[model samples]
Target chain A: MKVFLKLALFYGIINVFIEESLFNYPEYFPKTKYDFSKNNLSKTKIELGRMLFYDPILSIDSTISCESCHSPYNAFSHTDHRLSHGINDKIGKRNAPPLFNLAWKSSFMRDGAVNHLDMQSLVPITDSLEMGNSLDNLLYKLKKNQKYITMFYEAFGDSTINLDRVLKSISQFELTLISKNSKYDRFRLGEDHFSDQEIRGYELFKKNCSNCHKEPMFTNYKFENNFLDINQVLLDSGRFSITKNSDDFMSFEVPSLRNLSYTYPYMHDGRFSNLFEVLKHYSGPKFNSVSLTEKETIDIISFLLTLNDKEFILNPENKFPVNKLLK
Target chain B: MSNKFEKFAATCGFFFKYFISFLFIFFTYNLFPQENIEFQATFNNEATKLNKNYSIRKYHFNIKKLKFYVSNISYYNRKNDEIFTDEKVYLVDLNNPKSLKIKSQINKKSQLYSFDLGLDSVINVSGSLGGALDPIEGMYWAWQSGYINFKIEWESNMCSNDNNQFIFHLGGYKKPYYNKRTVLVKKRHIHRLIFNLNKFLKKINCDRQMIMSPSLKGENISNLIVKSFEFKK
Candidate 1:
């Protein structure tokens, strides 16, 4: 019994470090949907993953990284370009969506193609228009790097690198991108006050927008056709390409409104450049249900600005761990 | 002193007997090796020649690219008990004939056994485990988080499209579109499972060439592909 107690004590101490690297959200936020049991967290793995996220070694030409498309600032999304450019100056079809509070998400991609966060990296990594690197080749390249060798050892308890570990570690780092620190979050926690315009906008948001872009997480994560006319040039059929369901035609995943201030050039196609334009587009006759007068639209835009978590964007923890990167 | 000598001798006799028996079993075990059967997959009785045009039910086609996955390979004994074996997922590329061979280290062997054509729903959803199932193989569907179990790209005059292309991306881990199929084989220790693509394409009307999703059509073709693999006699 004493030996068993000693063993239990040993495990208890080990679990503390493992469990500490978890979703560090405020109490006001809803329960996360990420299943922690499948992929357990550890500080070493998350840090390694953060390093991997910032490192261009994951790319074929060592030019682009996960951070290239999903920048640490700008809410981990590219705001300058309407469409994400890849290696050798190749432009991709869709805009790279902002990534945060991903633990609560059920599906990924603007089209809801990737179901798991761990599996999400594979798409961009393998896409010829994007990274243009095979998982085998990427693994081979990372395996050759001594820095990654040490990091993989520290993260996985062995120097050997595999796809599962690499992907899961990336997922771990992405899972820590919790953004429950905005003025809206403070209001929920009773730590701050909102302006009357912000309050009115919040009320309007609850009535009209909250159905698709649900509360707290700010997304229901389901594909819906907002009746955007198909781009005759691109001929991108959105969710219809994946599901082949006629109802899914011209539909897109309801993007979270969090950090809209940083992640500009909005919509799946990056059509709208600002919140007011987005509001005007949504308020059109196609979406008569979201009828908003000019003042209400501005008020709503003001409320959206409150969703931008500056702390999250500038957080040092989410950036590359190494001071100097390999050229 | 005499009794002590007798005891020592008795102990020596016992040790020698056991040592001789151990050596006998060890040498015999080494002499006769357990079966480690390697299956070499071929398409229509040919791998290298498959890039050429072939006819199936009066429909002629030439394989531009042909690749598929075979997983969960194991051997079975006469008693119907599964021989414990290392689980391996093999990505077979008919274009590269060298990639067709799959070796399995198995115990409790028999001549007759079956294997999975593609990863089951479990491995399909479990995320990357490297090797054949790795996303690098181009077999994985990033959009839907599953694998394209079987793929065949060909140019056939039977296809009505201008390109005369017949592309089949058979996949789906979900119900009603589950694409994994099992094939039972016998008659040889080193199995030669023939994947007759002609039989598969014939099931689907040549006019309807493209199948890139999990649907009733894909499921029907996948079933036909399973039946198409002939065990070499």
Candidate 2:
């Protein structure tokens, strides 16, 4: 009896420690690209990150936070606008990308500018045309918040706000935005079945778009010259602007095909509003590039619809975190 | 009554021992410092004259800071007869070659040392936060939505009507464009490679102000920097 009691106590303590230390996800995914070893995730950190995502404190004049462009309902992507709107009603060049399943992404943004998730938030916070806020000023604002101070201390042992802690906290929350419960994922896991049309669409997608879109995670994460003509006004050369390689002319990051239903205004510039428009663009003379066939384009669009995961978008966990913040 | 008392005592004693063991494990894991090395990145421009043709009147060169946490830094001596090892090596000031310093943090009980480099060791040791947070790094180019890890800007008279300017923004962190380079230092020789920024400038003959993104140039600046790194005796 004494031995059993002692064993029970030991197990209880171990369980508490395990629950506090790490986050475990499903087994089907690849190893995460974000190095969590440097910035350990805690419950408080995730909460703080979520609050920051919803708060506009990150922007200049406190007008826009990450949520301004990436709303929760739209899978953390803006729905109404083609391009992202920044502080002082300024408009950015590219469309805001949806946020989800970030752990698998090796880079951030449509251009793949950031290599680490911990550093991804800096892009919107500092762009002169974006948020237009400096890091030091943002830290000062975070420090002023009594709630943030307590939360930061809880998440990172000390409330002392710095760039690393702020970035890491936001990363922690973003990592939790995993969208695995989609109908497509259910079909993959044998939990559900697809209709005949959906199955045909899946087959067509595998044949044509899977080369770029891939499986489970919808992107091969490669930059390809998708053959979209350069916008004379934006003059956005896509990947060519970064690499300076002529071959990369008109190349863009292959975005994930998931959440097509909610994450509308597709493409890098959000030129296409619906899947049909996207199909039309792919099939039309606009795509003068040597990439796709008409039939293949239709199939790829059909397959993209299957990527939508309603359960993820509706999850209350990822919602505004109002209760926690209010306290 | 005596037997019951003895059983209670035994259970309490067992619980106490387990609690102590648990505390030990918890404290040791959290308190112990794992081995890590600190690295610094510095930027410098050694160009004396701006090329007229390239529109580059002055060149501004900066090195992006990076930290490589290694278990040990060991090399073979000149004769290759023996191996000399330093457990910790830090990446020091990357911009200023003269200010770059790598120190080994030594473990008192073992052959381990903490390695640190540069003046802003702590800040540089932290990681890259894209364009929003830090501006000094120049890791972001908003029009492209990616980072230009290394940027060199120069004033030139090549392209512009008025002895104009030339700019080469070297960047691209993603696939087919990831520009991180590696270098190998031989045991005893000073291996140095010089970047001929002037050569690229000489091509245009100071006629047009050249605004060139290195990503567009297809030139490997990483290769230039890696080759330029030499081993000092």
Which candidate leads the pack in DockQ?
A: 1
lDDT of 1: 0.79
Alpha-carbon lDDT, every model: 0.79, 0.63
TM-score per prediction, in order, is 0.80, 0.65
- Measured with C-alpha atoms, the lDDT of residue B114 in candidate 1 is 75
| Stretches of candidate 1 exceeding 4 Å from the true structure | A1-13, A322-327, B1-67, B71-115, B152-167, B182-217
Cα miss at A137, model 2 (Å)? 1.9
The clash numbers for all candidates, in the given order, read 0, 41
Which digits, one per residue and each the tens of the lDDT, describe model 1 over residues A37-83?
67778888888888889888888998989988898788999987788
> Residue-wise lDDT of candidate 2 within A137-191, one digit each (tens)?
8888888999888888888778887776787788888988888888788887888
TM-score of chain B of 2: 0.38
Give each prediction's DockQ, rounded to 2 decimals. Answer: 0.47, 0.14
